[model samples]
Target: MNRLAILSVSDKTGLIDLARVLVESYQFQLISSGGTAKALKEANLPVTKVSDYTGAPEILGGRVKTLHPKIHGGILSRPDLESDRADLTANDIQPVTLVVVNLYPFEQTIAKAGVSLEQAIEQIDVGGPTMIRAAAKNHQYVSVLSNPAQYNAYLEELKAHNGETRIEFRRSLALAAFSHTQAYDRAIADYLTKEILNEAQAKIDLMEVSSTGATSSQPSLSSSYTLLCHSPKPLRYGENPHQPATWYQLGAAPKGWSAAQQLQGKELSYNNLLDLEAARSIVAEFWNDAPCAVIVKHNNPCGVAIAPTIAEAYQKAFAADSTSAFGGIVALNRPIDEETAKALTSTFLECVVAPACVASVATILAAKPNLRVLVLPEMQQGTSETVKLIAGGMLVQKSDDLPATPETWQVVTQKQPSPEQMQELIFAWKICRHVKSNAIAITGDRVTLGIGAGQMNRVGSAKIALEQAGDRTKGAVLASDGFFPFDDSVRTAAAAGITAIVQPGGSMRDGDSIKAADELGLVMVLTHVRHFLH
Candidate 1:
């Protein structure tokens, strides 16, 4: 009896070649179903239709074609066991040696612009995953291939071992098959979660308008969900040298940092990625504004500025705190030009990311061989949900990406800010939200003068930021992430020459701070929304 190979796939990328090799060179019998069988016959390769081999007609619109006992028994049988061999022989089933299968395009179907739920459900593969899992679970007796990219390697393995695959090679292929099914299941679960939640919200909106009963409570988060990550790339180390680290991409398709184009420099470390995300978030806040630049150190924005020219923005941001800017991560809203590239090379930095760069900018940046440069055009796009890991389980929440509405803010002081001061306050508030609490940021002329973050007390943070600004605090504005519980910070800001202040005003003693601002002739604006990043 000839060894049998089953070929069933939704993506027929390398199917013809693999089938031909198996039939002509290895003398293995081929069995296929539906479109795969049609494709093999069209390619002039000999194959046995799965229905013909199993002696059962395909039922339920081809959904029950491969769920027969003959197909699964052949795949799960043990050749060394007497009972298994007897069952196979009694049923006249050929023991399957190779199984090649790939799942349907469920992810692609849902990614369509206006795909309906029924359309997505129809694309979900049932028999395919079943066949794959069975083959993977019986890896000791069979070899399974779940991806088109594995075909060439499978051929190489067969050739290396004299027309047979080694046990270890089969084990690795089984692992790949299991991972493929797992990722497919996760995608389906996530899509259903979103769809079900949106549907529930729509019904609630309908009820609120029609019914006279008490209002319904908001829908809570899903009780459980799965997260799948693939393509693990090893890194040098994590935050410290002793800790090992690896980068795992979230999905099969790359986006965000995984899709970044690295123009030059060495690989990014764990800390570099963290700082880069912080820098990206800060720069994203000013994407619609003028040319903007942000410099981050230890995952906190040390400098952020917007200027008429990209080079000027970078220069002013660097001038915000030159000492801390050293070896910091940089993110820019505009493309890098000649002047900006020249200024960038003058300093030793860890990384620089931008929307794009001129053709000549690469050569200019070549001076710093160790600087990791990246280009991500869609810098404004971010994850809708943020996930954090705690002791045993993880926490999930909506990302704090609300827009800044300075127009809705109220003037809580006797002195009102000028138009220029209002713009400065808006800029300061946008940057303040990204800083770690207790956070305080001072800005002048649309550039960060000084930022104090992660302090124990609000007053300590204000003092650090004011002292960093020094003389620049004259005519500058200050923005705080939270409300001030006391008037000491307000008095201190006025004494440091801060002309305007912006903060969320929900504190019990807010009147004390307002009275101090009025007495000192300083402008105070209350936004009514507090942003605390810990």
Candidate 2:
């Protein structure tokens, strides 16, 4: 008797090729449903439709095609058990040897803009998950493939074992099948929860049409939380060599850091990736303005600069804090050139990331064998929300990515800033947002002169920044993540010869700082927005 194989899939990638090989090489009968059946027949391959094989017409617009007893019995039957064999024979059911199936694109559908709840509900697969779970539970006598990427591996296994899959291979595929269904169900649950919350909020808004004035700018919290991560790649260690670590990607398809191509050097450690992300975020701030470079150490940016050329940008950023730049992660907004590659290789850096790198420059970078080089084209794509695990729960909030609008700023001092000084202030303000509070950053001539981050108090942070800048503070600008509580910091900045100051002014004693700035003949601007990164 010929072996039986059921092929049902939403993604058609490598479908015809796999089906043809199964029919010609393995002598397996094909049973498919809906689009899969039509595709196989169109290619002039032999296939039996599920409706025809079960001797039942598809009802409810083809949704009831694969939920029949024959389909489930064939997938769950065990040839070794006498009772199962008798039941299969009594019902004239053929035992299914292989199940090639994938679910509908539910996540992709909901990712689109303006998708309705009904539309997303329609995309959720019912019979697909049912059949997948059944096959996975009976992996001893069945082999299930849930993704297109598994087709080649399945074929290789069959070829190696003389047209029969090994028990271990089938077990692995079964595990993947269950994981696939779990992720699908989680996506559906998350979508429904969000839509239901929005519907309830809309009703509340209608009830209080005139009583409540305005809604809060903050996004509402969700009651339910779900995360689907897979493909755990083990690292040598975490932040330290003693801590064990593993990297789990978010989805079946690789994205974000997983999508980045590492051109050379050692595997990335946990700390290396953290520092690289900090550098990436800071360099992304100046992506379209000019060639920019940022160096990060211990999850904080130590140097950031923008120049007319990529080589000059790296040089300026490195010169900003040479001592801290050693063994730091570097990010560049432009492609790596020969000049930049030479400058990058001159230092003992942990990693260097850019949008692109040519073959010649890559060869030059090869001189540093242990330095990691990554090319990620989408450097500006950031997460929509950030999550942190806490005691017995987690915290979730929207990312602080609000744009810096200098035109709406209030000049609260007697001295006004020039166009050039205003641009410098905006640059400093952008970098300050990424630093840990209490944060202070001093910049001059489009380069960071000194940075004071994660201090106990604002005055202490200001003193550290000014002392580090030294003579550079004479013509530089200062940016604070929060409003000054007193005029002492303002006086301290003026004493350091700070030409202008930018801060989020909402403190109770804002007048004292404004008066101090006016008396000291310094330009002070209030952004009306606070960016306190903890």
Candidate 3:
């Protein structure tokens, strides 16, 4: 008896070629359905229509074509068993040796322009997956071809090995086919449950979306969504040798940090990711047109500076808190050059992230194998939502979307700031927005002179900020992340020769801070909204 081969496909990429080989070279009887039969007939290939073979007309819009036993009995019959062969002979069913099939384009139909939900629902293949699975399950007796890419190799194997494909090759193709169908069904079910159904049901549907998409041409339902939480790996030890602890990447994807591509260095540790997050958040606050460098330590900004040259910004920021810069994470808005990398490697730093790294500079940094390097293709700027975990739930809030427009700002105090002072004040205000609550930023000549963050009271934060600035406070502009609870901070800043002040004015003692600024000959502007980074 001649070998039996079935061909059914929605995507007819290499169908004609496969059909020709099956009829002319292999002498296999080609059985096809609907469009497959029509296409094979046009090519003058010998083919049998599926409905004609089954002796039943296709019903229900061709959906009921291949669900009959005459087709599946041939595929499912055990060729090794005399009983199976007897049953197949009694039913006049020819045993199918090879099954070539691909499912309808459900994904493609759904992705099309102006495709209705009903139209997309119709594209879901039923009998196709059933046939594919039946053949795949009996891979020992059947050869399954789901992808057109596999056709040539399969034909070669059969031609070389007396028309029998290898068992291993058959098994691999079956596995891929099952996985493809599973992903497809999951996507369809998830889309229907979410988009077509109501909100309460939609939340439940959200959990069903798969992370991976099917790439294989065969229909297999093996790839499904699975939820697994991963534990973090601690480096060397914890905070101390006696401490037992590990860290994990937050299950939530890191916002803009995800765009960064690591160019060179060792795998990033928990501490490295934390510091990078802080630095990236701070640097992203500044416009991409501006050159900025942020040095982060223990999830806090030690120094941040904006300048015309990235090297100059890095130098100024490093000068701000040289003591805290040890093993710090550095982030830049621009690319890193050989000169900048050399300057950075001079100090012990954990990592550096930029848009691009020059090849020569990357080679230079390769000497330090422990240093982590990252390249961010795009910088995320502007206001985004912030989510914080509380005791049992999350607290979602709008980020500090500070108005960069000058019109929103009010010069409430008597002393008007000079042009240079105004520029530094605006820059300091932007940097301060990313710092922790009860924060104070002191800057001079576009460089952060000092930052006092996470303090208890406004006055204490101001005092710390002044102390950090030391002599640099002279001719520096001061910015408070939040409103001044008392006028003491304004007096302290004025006493330090702080040229101007920028802060949100919502406190009951705002009048006192304004009065103090007027008396001490200081330029104080109220932004009307507080920015508490914590």
Candidate topping TM-score: 1
Q: What ranges in model 1 sit over 4 Å off? A: 59-61, 156-162, 165-169, 209-214, 217-221
lDDT of 1 by residue, 1-534 (tens): 789988899999999999999999899999999999999999999999999999999998887889988899999999999999999999998899999999889987887799999989888899899889999999998999999999999999989888999889999999999989989988988888789888988878888888575466556655676677877889899999999999988876778899999999999999999999999999999999999999999999999999999999999999999999999999999998999999999999999999998998888999998989999999998878789999998888889999999889999999989999999999999999999999999999999998999999999999999999999999999999999999999999999999999999999999999999999999999999999998
- TM-scores, each model vs. reference: 0.93, 0.83, 0.61
Candidate 1, residue 75: how far the Cα is off, in Å: 1.7
Which is superior by lDDT, 1 or 3?
A: 1
Point to the candidate with the largest lDDT. 1
Clashes per candidate, residues 3 or more apart or on different chains: 0, 0, 7
Each prediction's Cα lDDT score? 0.93, 0.91, 0.81
Order of the predicted models by TM-score, top scorer first: 1, 2, 3
- TM-score of candidate 3 on Cα atoms, chains taken together: 0.61
Which parts of model 3 are misplaced by more than 4 Å?
1-256, 381-383, 401-403
Candidate achieving higher TM-score, 1 or 3: 1
- Ten residues in sequence with the least summed lDDT for candidate 3: 221-230
